[model samples]
Target: MQLVLTVLEIVSPVFILALIGFGWVKAGHEYRIEFVTRLAMTLSIPALIFVALVNAKIEPAALTSLLMAATVGFAAVTAVAFVAVKVFKLEIRTYLAPLIFGNTGNLGLPLAYFAFGDEGLSYAVVVFAVMALWSFTFGVYVTAGGGHPGKVIKEPLVGATLLGGLFLWQGWTLPTFAMNTLDLLGQIAIPVMLITLGVAMARLQVNSMGRAVALSLGKVILCAGIAAVVGQWFDLAPVPFAVLVVQLATPVAVTSYMLAEKYGAQAQEVAGLVVASTFLSVIYLPVLLGLLL
Candidate 1:
């Protein structure tokens, strides 16, 4: 009961309020939401990543585990998504982005922080960086069909990751003032993302709910199961391994909708997946935490 309550306390009100705000103001205004999401994707999120990775103290071995879990989960999901597209004859153009881009930032980061503290958060950051790269490049290609996927290489996150990598390689640290400023900017990224997500959710149609539910379950349950088995084999600690599993279990990212919109995939369908996964995450997250923690 206490665990259940804790989960509810942490997740529900934020989501509920965001839903209400979206319904009240932004449901019909997709453009407005898109503008804000772009700001996050292009600016605040990258800053957050830069600060997190540059400052994070990562063990070489731990980094290997983190990379392993991310790679395995990505491969598993990609294979499943391939099968999904083939079996359903899904318009190859439409389903590819959501099929690949699971919610790593919003749902995954928080759960990782809660479960394994800063170390888990670092791992989640690495996963987010990886997903962002793949989502922008291959995901765009899959969505655009005949267009140039090369444009994805120029995205801000890609540049930021390169810069951050330079810093990591050099063992560089930011000055106090610079670190503080980046942290301040980084803090805003998550809440803005959540509120925007709520706004996006307000626009979802009831008829689309079933498909979204199925997709969300596929991400959380199927992906998480694969992560757990692989993590155990790799001998990851229970907490960190569980953090990876839960991160896999997070909802489809709002970024999916944004990317789908930008690339001309089924944006509304992607949005529905984001909203549905988030709503269901309220239940699934706690259940997962109970079992894993």
Candidate 2:
């Protein structure tokens, strides 16, 4: 009973904020999703990443181990997802990337912050960064057939991650006023993202519920299982291990649907994935958190 409430406390805000966006969109209001997403990705999210990394209290060695774990974990997921795609005779370009890459940014960060506090957020950002790097490069390649990996350098999030890592390594700190301003910008990321998630959910048009559900279930199991095994192999501490599993097990990213649309690889099918996976997360995340806690 106490555990249920604890899990509720952690996840309620996330769902509620998403619900607000869902409701807002349903009420005939307008939301410029592209604009908001651009703003968050280009500005606020980078600030958040930079600030989180710069101020993280984790040791260099622990973070290094976590990085190795995350890299190996994602690689394992990719291999497994590829096999599943081929076995099911699914469209490789349409399904593989989405299965391999979860919604680590939109859903993972806030859950980590709420569930484990600052320390969790710190660890969460590392995993998020790793996923982002992979998603921008290999994930894009798989989805689009060919992509400019060099263009990844121009991404604000990538820049922030690199800069933040430099600062973290050098033991650098920003001035009080500067840090405060960046922190303020970082603070805008979570609520906006949550509401945006809800808005996206309300607007998504699912094409096939059965396939989506089955695929989503497979993705969650594969990702979480691989992450758990990798975390254990790396001897990660409890919180980082949990963070790794949760991040890897997040719902299919909305970006996956967007990428499918952009690449002409069956947008509606990917939309089904985004919606079905997100809905699945609403049930599984809380249950997973209950056990993890």
Candidate 3:
């Protein structure tokens, strides 16, 4: 009973903020998702990443280890997702990337911060950066069924990610005033992202509940199992290992649905995934956190 409350204490704020966004949208308020998302991804998130990385107290070697673990873990997830789609005779273009790329940024970051503290959030950002890079490159290609994978170069978030890594590696620090300002901007990221997530979900329309439910369940099991295995294989430290598992086990990204819409690859089906997987996460994430805690 005490444990349940502990877990609840950690997880409640995230879901509550999201619920506010969800409720806001359902209440017929104007959200302007595209504008809010643009602000978050381009300005706020990059600032958050830069400040977190530059100010992070983690050792460089530990970051490298976690970085490599995330790289290999993503590769493994991609390979497994591909095989699953092929064996099931599902549409590779539609199912592959969504299965492989989870919502590491929006959901994963805040969860890690709450459950494990600042050190955990620092580690979580490394994994998020890796996943973002891959998702921008290969995830795009898979969804588009053949597009330029080099488009990651044009992303501001990607630039911030690389810049942050460089700072972390070089043991550099910004001036105090500048750092504090960036920290303040960065502070806006998590709560805004949580609310945005709810707003986005409220706007999503799921068309195929059956397939969505099944695939959502499959994603939870496959991602969590694979992350757990790889985290052990790499012998990750306690916080990083739990962060890896939880981040990888996040729900299908709303970006997947947007990609499907853009690429003409069954938008409604991916919407089903976004909805089902997110709904699943409300239950799934807490259980995972309980174990990790």
Candidate 4:
């Protein structure tokens, strides 16, 4: 009972904030998703990543292990997704990347902070960083049919990650005034992302929900199972282990839908995926937190 309550306490706010956005959209309010997402990605999220890493009391060895585990876990999941797509005769261009890469940023980071506090956020960021790096590079390549490697370094998320790691390694921080400013900017990221997620979901049109649900479920199971295996294999600590699994278990990102639309793939199919998977997460995430706790 207590554990269930704990999980509820952590998850309720996340869903509530999202529901606010959902309600806002339903009420005919004008929420510009692209502008908000652009702002969050370019400014807020990067700031959050930098500030979180700089302030986190994580050990280098643990960070290294989590990074390694995240890298391996994502690669393995991608391979499995590829095999499944082939066997199931699904379109590789539409489904593979969505299945392999979860929404570690918008959902994972905030959930970690709620579930396991700042320590978990620190751990979650490592996994998020890996996902960001992989998705920007390999995911872009897959989605776009071909992408430039140089584009990876040009991403602010990548730059923030690298800079954050450097600051972490050197035990350095910005002056108090600068740090506070960055922290304030970073604070906008989580709420903006959460609200944007809901707004995006509200706007999505699902063409094939049945297939989307089945494959999305498969993704959740495969990703969580694979992350668990990798976490155990790496001997990750309790918080880090839970963070790894939870991050991987998040729904298919909204970016997948946008990418599919932009690349002329099955955009409606990907939209179905984004909606079904996100809807599933509302029920599943709390259960996952219950178990993890």
Candidate 2, residues 49-144, lDDT tens digits: the string is: 999988988887888888899999999998888998999899999999889888888899999999999889888888998898889899888889
lDDT of 4 by residue, 1-293 (tens): 99988989999889888898889999999998989988999999989989989998999789989999999999999999999999999888898889988889989999999999888988888899899888888888888899777888888988998899899989999999999999999999999989988888888888868998998899999999999999999999999999999999999998888889999889999998889999999899999988888
lDDT agreement with native, every candidate = 0.72, 0.92, 0.91, 0.91
Name the weakest run of 10 consecutive residues (lDDT summed) in model 4: 147-156
**TM-scores across all candidates?**
0.84, 0.98, 0.98, 0.98
Question: lDDT by residue for model 1 over 148-213, one digit each (tens)?
Answer: 557667777667766776687678878999989988887777677667667766665535778878
Worst 10 residues of 2 by lDDT: 203-212
Q: Candidate 3 vs. truth: CA RMSD?
A: 1.0
In terms of lDDT, model 4 sits at 0.91
Ranking the candidates on lDDT from highest down gives: 2, 3, 4, 1
Candidate 4 TM-score versus the reference = 0.98
TM-score for predicted model 3 compared with the true structure: 0.98
Alpha-carbon runs more than 4 Å astray in model 3? none
Off by over 4 Å in 2: none
How many residue pairs clash in all the candidates, one count each? 0, 0, 0, 0
List, residue by residue over 125-174, the lDDT tens digit for candidate 3: 99998998898888878888777767888787789888998998999889
